[model samples]
Target: MSKFSFPFFFIVLLVGSSCKEERQNDTAENFTEFVNPFIGTGGHGHTFPGATAPFGMVQPSPDNGTTGWDWCSGYHITDSIISGFGQLHLSGTGIGDLADLLLMPTGKTLDVSLFGTTRDSLPYTSRFSHSSEIASPGYYKVNLESNNIQVELTANEYVSFHKYTYQNTNEPSFVIDLGYAVNWDTPTESSITLESETQIVGYRHSTGWAKNQKVFFVVETSEPIVSSQFMANSETLDSKNEAKGIKTGGQFFFDQDSTKTVEIKIAVSSVSIANAKENLISRGNSISFDEVKSQTNNKWEALLSKIKIETPQDSLKTIFYTALYHTQIAPVLFSDVNGEFRLQNDSIDSTQDWNAYSTLSLWDTFRAENPLLNILQPERANDIVQSMLAYYDEQGRLPVWTLYGNETNTMTGNHGVSVITDTYLKGIRGYNVDKAYEAVRNTMMGDIRGLAPYKKYGYIPYTELDESVTISLEFAYNDWCVAQIAKDLGKEEDYKYFSNRSKAYKYLFDTDTGFMRGKSGDGKSWNEPFDPKFSSHREHTDYTEGNAWQHSWFVLHDVPGFIELHGGNQTFTKKLEQLFTESSEISGENVSADISGLIGQYAHGNEPSHHIAYMFNSAKEPWKTQYWVRQILDTQYTQQPEGLSGNEDCGQMSAWYVFSSLGLYPMNPASAQYEFGSPLFEKATIAISDTKNFTIIAENTSPINKYIQAVKLNGESLQRTYITHTELMTGGTLEFEMGPDPNKNWGI
Candidate 1:
């Protein structure tokens, strides 16, 4: 036997013996200790280091600015100043919105003269250093240098709990600002009312990415209010307890003490102030901040323990756990404690049977994040499908991108279809299958986002739309997802029709240039002066966030056909090799900033190129997939604030890292298949279900021994390069023998 085989066999025996007991106590592992919440807060990652529960409705974090792309999450690592701490925040998004219910605790009174001025001139701002800041999965703490106050934040599902400690100051006041808005967000109307001596209720209606957004909040303080000053648009209101206008806020004075600590809790709802109050009450007003903090920590621990990895490298463990943490921050709870949620038409729905969710970044997440959720969080996946169906019922079509209760219509394609289809195909049937099929079918058949032109012309014409080729490719993939459900439902005619529509990508392919180029309305000629590396941001371009080279390989449903389009295996493999070896420079005066994490022309930062590396498996070059996947794993991610290469895009970037590091990826997200890459750990176990566990063991796996030499599934030799979702969930052991060089003949 080889030197590595004895330990591998011994581990297999131990895992097989203890599998059932481990499943019973999966949460016994403290996986949250490995998570670093600030890994993506710097560079262009656009993630916030905040305090939030898993899929919680509230994300309370400090805001540094209201302008600039770096402040999309309201907090960046480079910033030193803090405007205030807001109740709602977006994580790793390209567009910014929802920094509502801003609260600032100060030692001195605010200047009423600067009420209507820009946020930068506000006197309540404070400066803090990174050395004095600390962040983890469910908590954040910072010492404000301006007032010598230390702030700590924690949260539950719908409520944010704040603790402030004042030192060396006599005056202790609080400012409740309803007029605070961040990038892409503008306060259309707001109001604040002091309901009691220690209670406040208000609402903020804004217009931004999600038009006509509504946020109702209820705040409760441990200390009673002594005095109050309400203002609107730089003018003090006549009413001492209330303020209502486009710009509204208030300054409230509490009991003065030299050294004091105050606790505040803020609950929010999309339905009404009454619902927000009920949500706050449901958490028990007397619950201590430390108790809530401990609860949130336990929640995170249970979720993060779903997949336990054994690796010698601590940095890899941190990166893996942090990536996993980011995936659960969104698709947050939208329903109140009383099962009340707002609809897209601004109507309240009080009969929600399941927990409603929002912040669906489907355009980016359907590729990897949703797939990961299916494996780790199958029940939440069902709720996500139900949420999409609810949106379809509220609107005529499914959500492209939604926040809170409104659809932003951001990005392209109805990728909610992909999420629903993937969920159902994975044997999760907590939703109505027929209704999901109808929703996807109607969405693709409808006339929106160039779908009418795509249906009529087999391709969206460049003359009619900006991202014609990109839309056609993405729509084709979604259509494939629709066809899968049709086939499953035994609708033969519908399946055949949609299956043909799924090939709409062929209409945009240019055999002469070997790229997916844009064609005119008449379909007579390609767009002129075409360069594969050229990119433009939402301008006269045929791509969305990428160029021809990146978008051309997006045929996830038909990779074999895509390879054939490039003239068979050898030629296609050569062209694929060139994608990473070509020049990294882009040829455009105004290129999309989304195209980042560039290794030559392969942009790992964006979603378009996420599955391109795995296409080598279809071209019969699995070794190249292993090589490139390892390269991306080593180079594109790290354990620092500036670790990520591009926007987290609501966890899609991190999801890519999580899946790729595990030696598998969902090349076709809805296909329920995972292609193997290079596994990073020696042993990784997944809690497949209540009583079952799936374990993957890689022997002699190190930086030098990166290539897979052989593989076994339950002690039998495996030949295929991919594994099915059914095979994975069946709970068996997948063992791989690692060597220094690629054994190209092993998987083939």
Candidate 2:
């Protein structure tokens, strides 16, 4: 072929590839997979520095975090050394466990301590040198100092792929602990049954946050193993259930090692072994690495497109987009090709037809994540509601921090009801609404552990429930969300009932103290010397991973009502300011590190405070919201490894950024309205749908110029606490002039 022919041929191939990718139904120009997975590796960020497609089932990365804390999602920024990457990790949870299904690559014997940490036992670890590691959001590469091996990791819907370069071909050998498990750190059973030279079905089962989680796997090796070991616990699995689990692995050998690559694909199901087998078999061994990588890249594109934010500051874009990526990564697509899934109830095989989802970090996501999903990707929102409804149908109630098919019920309060109710209210589809109503009511009014404390005490009363003050406040807001949802669905009785239930928080309010205090089980009594910051009985109440100062503003559904609770708009505004800058002197409980964007007592780091900035619209002053929103956009967020100052909280943290940057936030998610907030970009363009596009053009908009001088919708002056979904979806221009100083009287 002539040189010109080769060039023309290459262009044709590129165009053809682009056309083929277009078939996946994702926007292309918007996605850049250059995310550094190692960004959050330091700090108690709990992120695995690994590579995976946006929202894919696989999270292939090194499992460097062995601290067994909630932050160990991947490797900790504070750790001194590296550990092999694990396939699956639970996201942003308070409990430490389930670093299940690990994959390690080596050029020599794996000398690292499987137990994690050496004899000196540093109280806290030193930061990992950045020179030793590299990460982008969708992919990660790390070099182990001890082994001198370069390890790369990536993930797709349910499979993890790894590439390792050994220092020397002869010294290279890898390890797979069929017996490995995490934080409920004891493995009850493990076995590696060699199915053949190239395939192995390994199994291991142990107890952790999800008790009695039986893990079974069928791993097909890309190469043959020269040496492999099978280690099982002294105990054996109940013979009857042996077909289902008891962890095991398959190791392959090579005649001699060079820079050979080992790819291990895995699928985890709450359902059956056969389904897992089908899941594995569906992706035949002949598939190319680039094909899988491309599939993941495109998926990332679609997810990233769901919310697009462009800015002059590249760092802001990285932070905004990365946070956006993190939110959609979990509660992933849980169904297989035939729609087989692990049912809500563990016995499995019940639903070989529909869909099932697990790993719902509801308490955190119920605030921002689900609402964000409802607004942007309503279709997926519907499926998530249906999945939770299915949980209620099969498990008998809406889940409380559900994992795998089991209910760890880790967090306090029932917020998934809010997710269901919020989605349903928005006229979103893909769920059985009536069934969802049933589940919502059951969870709200049913006989769960926290209900009596909720119903009888208005909020969980101290005399009635230990975390009385904390539980009462949060329950009240969620109660309102549920009731609002019920009312929208025309469940009149439920509407009235839950509406009253939501007001239960009023009882806990100590007008004299001007704080939410614990009430006694008896109608007239209250906790003595009430300090909102302190936990009553060390129970996870009076705070859902927060303090009374933090929980005081939990009522985002009815911000006006929350203002009313504070006496009036003026007083409420004063307290609101105090909250943003509130300092904790007592230091009651050890709080999560992600709760760091402090404005006095207000915490922008976690979900509870996500809606706080918009509360300004409810007050006589909207400028404060402008001030803090700009401060957060400029400072709390950056395009660096530790870009986010708080928990990704499954994406709530990032969703908050995405919405804020777009000059809008779901001030009231169920209300089908977006509250205007400070815009971070000079010009933000949102393509709401194929035919509808929206743009925000700021006049003198910048980090210093934070206030909105004025507002206009399409060309008309607009003054409203909220914007309608109609106006937004109509896709028009929202223009504003901003300044560093608050234009306090402008919006008011």
Candidate 3:
């Protein structure tokens, strides 16, 4: 195992080895101490040195650097200091948001600013030597020297793990206060209600990406403190302190000196106070911390096991599995036990097992990950589609950026339509197809359509509002996917409508310039100089977070058409090669690290380029695909903080790596076809489904023979990059003869 495996396996094994009964399955052995949340607990990583339930929506951790960034997800590798942990962390957010409602333990008067302290002026923050931090996939732990508090934090779906150790000495006390705000907007009203001698519940009205959200939490401790403090503008806090009425923050400390350890349990709700109370009742605090962590790990294992790829190379296997792991982290469950959930319309609704999962950046996932989900996690894909459908039913439109039940509409394009359209075409069963169709249509053609910009202006025109070029290219592709979905359902008019709509990119396609250019509403004049490179589309130029090199190949539904548009195969290949080997001139925009792996302007880090590498298959030049795909796998990704080089983009990046490493890529998800590539392992098999009990295998593969000599499905030769979902689900073996170098005309 590589050095990465130690920490990686430790987290997995700790969670997997939940109890003694399952000791037999604990095959992967390792030696490691408890975790250190303080490790990646700061800087660009956005990780908090706190406990969380695995993949659970509620992440309670300490807030040191509440300033938002991706590293803030849990902890960043860049930060060197130790701060307290808050309960909520938003993973990999480009715009630092949602490290809200911080709870820290301190003895001094409560102060919120972090400016007074410097790296040297305050050594307590850095007193945490790196040797003392323990971090795994599911757990973290560290000790605070300033206060002599040893902290251990982990997760167990919807529950957090916290173990605070107060060393045997004086100042044996702790504090829990709710006055801190985590990117919290001013609440219209705030109130703290006592539930019992040992419990407190309250509501904090705040707004940000998840606007109009009313946060309610129930906190119960293993032991009760002798006293509690409230600061609502000076209302008698204690003999020396008083509740300051309408004060911004308040805190209370534990009075006992003999107590050495303590644990806290909390539950949050977005619906109502009653629902928050119910959320607590559902989890009656009897389960051990180990048990919860173990349970959460098992849940992850079961989910991950749906698609099992067995390869001899541990790194390849680990990377593949880890990529698969990262892919499933989002579209998180946002419902309560009663099937009640917040709707996109912002109304709390009651349903029967119908829940909403948000943070689905489907514009990226539709390339490969969703297709993977349809086959391995069809049930989950169905639920996701159902949730989108439910979003339509409630919000009267499909979602863009959803938090719990709220939709932020952050990004461009309406991909919920394409996802639904593709799901229906793939023959998956989960939601009402008719309702799904209605949603697909409403989102594709909504009066205030997110996609309307593309249709009206031939391409999305960068007006005072909107990402013109990017929205155009993306909408064109999504609209094309919708056209396919429309065709399948025999909605002739809708098919023709979207089919016509899908070609809107052609208007911006400068036949003379041979690039998709941004145009104004007048449609004759193109955006000046039209350089796709160094253009930060985020400023509403033409593209979205990309330059010409990245957006040029956005059309995936019709590669042949795109190649023809580019004036044939040879020129197309030349342009693509330049895209990969060219340099990127940095523009000072928040160009998502997702746009990493710059070859000229071709960024392997983002989604637009995901299919560009595979599009070579369309020209029957499979050798190029093999070369670039292998190169991308080897160099662009690693097993460390800088490892990703881009946003996981809701598993889209991971899914791309997973799919490509398997020697197959999903060019189009709803089509049930995968573009074949060179497999990166000796042997890889997909256990089809439970009822079918079938499997697909790739044999005689290795790093040397990374080029596919030939592929046989079941027992026959294949012509194209695609294989049916049914053929895969029914089970079969895909044998291959890989070689060190390309066979000049091998896959050709």
Worst 10 residues of 2 by lDDT: 1-10
Which prediction has the highest lDDT against the true structure? 1
Each candidate: RMSD: 6.4, 7.4, 5.3
228-300 per-residue lDDT for model 1 (tens digits)? 8888977777787998998889887877853388899999999899999999999747798999998999899
Candidate 3 off by > 4 Å: 1-55, 66-74, 106-127, 169-189, 232-249, 344-346, 447-453, 462-466, 587-594, 691-700
Worst 10 residues of 3 by lDDT: 31-40
> What is the model-wide C-alpha lDDT for candidate 1?
0.87
lDDT of each: 0.87, 0.63, 0.62
Q: Tell me the TM-score of each prediction against the true structure.
A: 0.95, 0.87, 0.87
Which one is best on TM-score?
Answer: 1
Model 2 Cα lDDT, one tens digit per residue, 599-674: 6766666676777778878896888877777767766665444656666656666777788887788866666788
lDDT of 3: 0.62
Tens digits of per-residue lDDT for model 3, 1-748: 1223234544543553343222212235221111222322222333343444434657655444433355436346555555456566655444444544444444443432231132233212324544456554455666676666777666655555566776753434344333433343333445565556466667665566677665666666676655554545323344323222232234444545656677766667767667766776676368665666566556655665655555544445455665766666566666766667776455776656555566666666777767777777777788788878777877787776666577777676777877776677778857787787777777767646445555556566655345667777777777777778678778898888878877876777777767777777777887776555655546656667677778877776777887888888887887777777876776645554446666667777677778888878888788888888888888765544455556666567778888888777877665677777777755555656655543445565665667776777778986556677777777777766677777666556
| Total backbone collisions for each predicted model | 0, 48, 55
Q: After superposing candidate 1 on the true structure, give the runs of residues whose Cα lies further than 4 Å from its correct spot.
A: 1-29
